[model samples]
Target chain A: MSESAIITPPLSDDDIMKLKIGDRVLITGKILTGRDSAHKRLFDLIKEGKSLPVDVKGQIIYYVGPAPAKPGYVIGSAGPTTSYRMDPYAPLLMEHGLKGMIGKGVRSQPVRDAMKQFKAVYLAATGGAGALIAKNIKSARIVAYEDLGPEAIRELEVENFPVIVANDAYGGDLYQEGIKQYRR
Target chain B: MRRDISHEKIKDTVARLCIDANYFLGNDMIQAFKSYIENEESDTGRDILKQLLRNAEIAEKEQVPLCQDCGFAVVFLEIGTGVCFEGNIIEAINDGVRKGYTEGYLRKSILSDPVKGKNTNDNTPAIIHTTFVPGDKIKITVAPKGGGSENMSEVKMMKPADGIEGVKDFVVDRVLRSSSNPCPPTVVGVGIGGTFEYVAFLAKKALLRNIGERNTDPFYADIERELLQRINNLGIGPMGLGGRTTSLDVFIETHPRHIASFPVAVNINCHVARHKTAII
Candidate 1:
């Protein structure tokens, strides 16, 4: 019922403050991609007080593992994977200035708490919608963890990528609010 | 009268089924989405359903996977007692999985080991369930199950005294607790009775039924209807952003259990629900 808000990442406090749960968003520009294995490796590096292969500040990582592209395609079917598996690494990533996450399913309470504390928000694309979602990705190149295969950290150039604000910095949660609205 | 079936027939059929199942969703599921879209109250929920339908269309037209997970290859094989296979059945099926995943560009999700194993690179060694039947033909069904929804499955052994209320409570509780984790607008496959492991298999087998199809047993059909309604009341809409269409359908499969054991399992399947069937 509301118009989708356009957002470009490296989101500032002011930008975070303006978003709300349930608001539709169109994200453009570059974003990062990773899932369970990649997150685990990054989490350990942070724990060891070592520098990361890529900087985390002002970046949004999509929890996705894409199918391989055929010839003449920028990427193959790519959609958000469940976010819960990466719960252990999220709060720490937030602490390191990861401003946003794009994934599906519910996050742990700690991740939500970190969202409020760190001014990060969790967004969701339609789950199981791999092919349609991939159309928005203009280009993709692996940035790190190539051996991880699909779980590798790939940087993506996306335009008008559709998502919904599932969790906002002000502690608004869309999943709970939607359930509350319709629960009979 | 016996009919001979070579391993090549099965291998080629499975390889083709694997690609088709991942690339094209069943029409019944597309109908479910069309109907649910009309009834889903949330604007977001309806939009998500629309996108899903579009995703399926694109997958078919583009010859791509419906989901990136592509899933664990679960094959259901029913061979007639009069049919004899010429080669190793397991090897043929594995060869099919490897061929399909590679040729179709689907994700190879299997690992040689569970915890510390390297990727198999080619998805093979499908989770196969074989049964002997009355006819001379062989029937094959390939259901590629995604991990997101599969992780939400559970197996619980309840006391016989726990009764119907306990079973209902467990099914509802699992979905409620699951929230959007399994991907919303899921299919709830309930397997009741049998041993713990058999119950789990029943639950997954229950998923092979078409969406909105009820169990043949009147008693289970009623339970499926009730559970479906109760789950929709939870308001977990599409993608778990909250909506009235939490479950596209609920299916219950029952087997006779021992006097003391009442094992029940729930296998959740996402909206994409990919499966295809072929007979040889």
Candidate 2:
């Protein structure tokens, strides 16, 4: 309910501690992008004891597969896809120093527990507002799996990218607590 | 008496509809958002709704997709018995989809195979449902369904004894369990009766109706009203962060079922609610 928190990752432990469920934040700087297809690949790599294409250390992974950038735009319709699809891979990524996840919807309990244990947090942008969200992304380029097209892993440079802290390291969950306050 | 419609004309119309529907959200939803903003108690919910309105404006002005998940094209074709087309109708429709998704810069989300999976790349081979009606004109409706919401849809085979209350409980519980995952402020479509596959289609088709457009049958209209109220009260809110606008509307479409069976389907649509229709 207070003013927005500004975040630029690789977020520090202290930075993760400061976020609370329901707090608004404007994120700047770089973030990694991946979705269902990319998560499956990452999960496979982890199981095979192979190093990832990009380091997971102190990074934020955005659950997105954005439309191809148009002629004059840096990105196109960049918005969070649903997050639960990445649940199977999230805890392991967190263990490897994945400090943050950006997406929409509720996460599994294991993922929430991982956030608390690993000093990580989950944030969600407004879903379905892709065109508006795309404006906040300053640059986007694929970093891996080019053949997967939209589902490819990419790096994005964003500014004032708005999101709400959905899960925090302190075991706070906005999706659960927020609904509790209003559900009749 | 036969009426001729050219394949080229149909293809062009479908292509235009595919692009236009993604850019311009229906006015009914826009008005609903405005009204919901005034009444929504949660600050976050109101803010999200405002962002949605702005998103719509940006998409319209810039001629871009409102959501990155451009959606699976679910086209409904009602071809009149009196109407005639020269070339392959299905081919023309697919060609139109290929043209629209490619030329309009929409994302290619369709996989060629469900399990073996490779991107069709052009968003083709649309899920087309065709019917033969009495008139000479053909009616086409495109409802772009996103995976997030479609994944939440369900079909239930209930016993005759479970009755209406069972139907209500199942529908409400499905939404409750799904909560934020379907992108709240969803549109709930209920299909009662019919075979398994047909019931699912009825639920999906029901979503294409304009906001607040109730069923013509009084009994079913009341059911829609009750379902809407129940869903909104669940407080899933905008994007499921919580508020009073969990669902914009509930649509119920019913058909005669076999004496022994009562089947129901719930098809949830995200707040995007993209559907466009044209008559030719």
Candidate 3:
């Protein structure tokens, strides 16, 4: 991979769409956290024509359920949960200007297609590296549904949050490519 | 002949075990992580492995849970027919789970109902699977199963003709299909024979085996080795970033069943593999 390829500008949908597989992304700024429960609630809000707890427009959603924080810690071990559980609701979120997703695992085809149409990217965080990822989250505050436990939505400020381009805007999937390269 | 076991003892043990298992990655799992870091050909895979090892070290030193999802407390109990419990075994287990989860500062993951969502804030009542084994001592094994890998686990019933080959194929297929979802370089537990439920029980029991340990039976051991190789060959790699070493080990536990039945179950465990055992 070229050094230029690794350096992606603060992405807009157009910029995200041009990304190729194997690109390394350093995401800054705000990201929203949601897991199974939060996804359901978000979709329900949309269905009810009620404003979502957090606006998703041109934003990235991370599929994470963080542990409770210790004293002086903003958040506890915050890692990606399985992405497929969010698969059912992701495309709908994408239609509302969701530009990227941060999580692990393969996404459904409709989600992938939505990315192509919306120029979104799917970034994969290391699955078991929760504590490491948590260190990158500078601040976290529960924005909605605090009763959902760890599955509640939280807005976070991240710095150099490490992630890899799993699904690029052009419909290239690293998982499929990785398996095909190694599968005998 | 059941020996009376104290509720306090069970509770204390459960709490200590929960904190220890979550803070410290088992020796076998650590060794597997080290091996993958050294041997993985992909730079990305190696980097991820390094991060995992670092995460384990930080969690241990800081006395924090390894993964954010401390997981649902699953207790596997083997009750001795010769020993009687003074109080309710189920209640003792639940009490212990509550104390452990509370004191450990682990996340409360259990819900009262799957459909009507309600948080059981103490991470209980625990999922207790008990059995009457021929023994004088009671054994408790605690596996704090994370949600990511548990979501990916599946069980299937195959025709008797599928045999060992079919079992192997199914296990590999599941892991491959799981890809990065379950967190690769995983531990795969295969349970064969018995009825459907028994098959699943055996599969989970198989996960209790230490990584890289072989089955006592030579034939089964050989098959385990072959399955491990085939799974690694899938190249799901560490964290599925792509390279070799998708699975660190494959363990199978089996039992006899009816002539016309062939049942197989696959339980996938992530790299964390947080579990500890105690005998009393």
TM-score of each: 0.98, 0.99, 0.95
| Winning model by DockQ | 1
Please list the C-alpha lDDT of all candidates, in the order they appear: 0.92, 0.91, 0.84
What candidate 2 gets wrong by more than 4 Å, as runs, is none
Question: TM-score of model 3, chain A?
Answer: 0.93
Off by over 4 Å in 3: A1-11, B1-4, B133-136
lDDT (Cα, tens digit) per residue for candidate 1, span B1-280? 7999998888899999999999999999999999999999999999999999999999999999999999999999998999988889999999999999999999988888898887898987799999999989999999999999999999999999999889999999999998998888899999999998999999999999998788888988998999999999998899988888999999999999999999999999999887899999
Q: What C-alpha lDDT, on a 0 to 100 scale, does residue B143 get in candidate 3?
A: 91
List the pairs of residues colliding in candidate 1: B237-B243
Worst 10 residues of 3 chain B by lDDT: B1-10
Model 1's CAPRI class is high
Q: Give lDDT for model 3.
A: 0.84
Task: Name the candidate, 1 or 3, with the larger DockQ value.
Answer: 1
Q: What would the per-residue lDDT of candidate 3 be over residues B1-280, giving only the tens digit for each residue?
A: 5567788888777778777877888988888888777878788788888888998988888777888888878888888889777788788888888887777778888889988868989989887888889977888889988878887778798998897889889999999888888888789989989998899888888888998889999999999999998998898887776888798899999999889899899999898888898888
> Which lDDT tens digits does candidate 2 get at residues B206-234?
99999999999998899889988898888
| Inter-residue clash pairs, candidate 2 | none
TM-score of every candidate's chain A: 0.97, 0.97, 0.93
Q: Which runs in model 1 stand beyond 4 Å of their true positions? A: none
lDDT of 2 by residue, A2-119 (tens): 6686889888899889888888999999999999889889889999999999987889999998987789998889889999999999999999899999998999999999999999
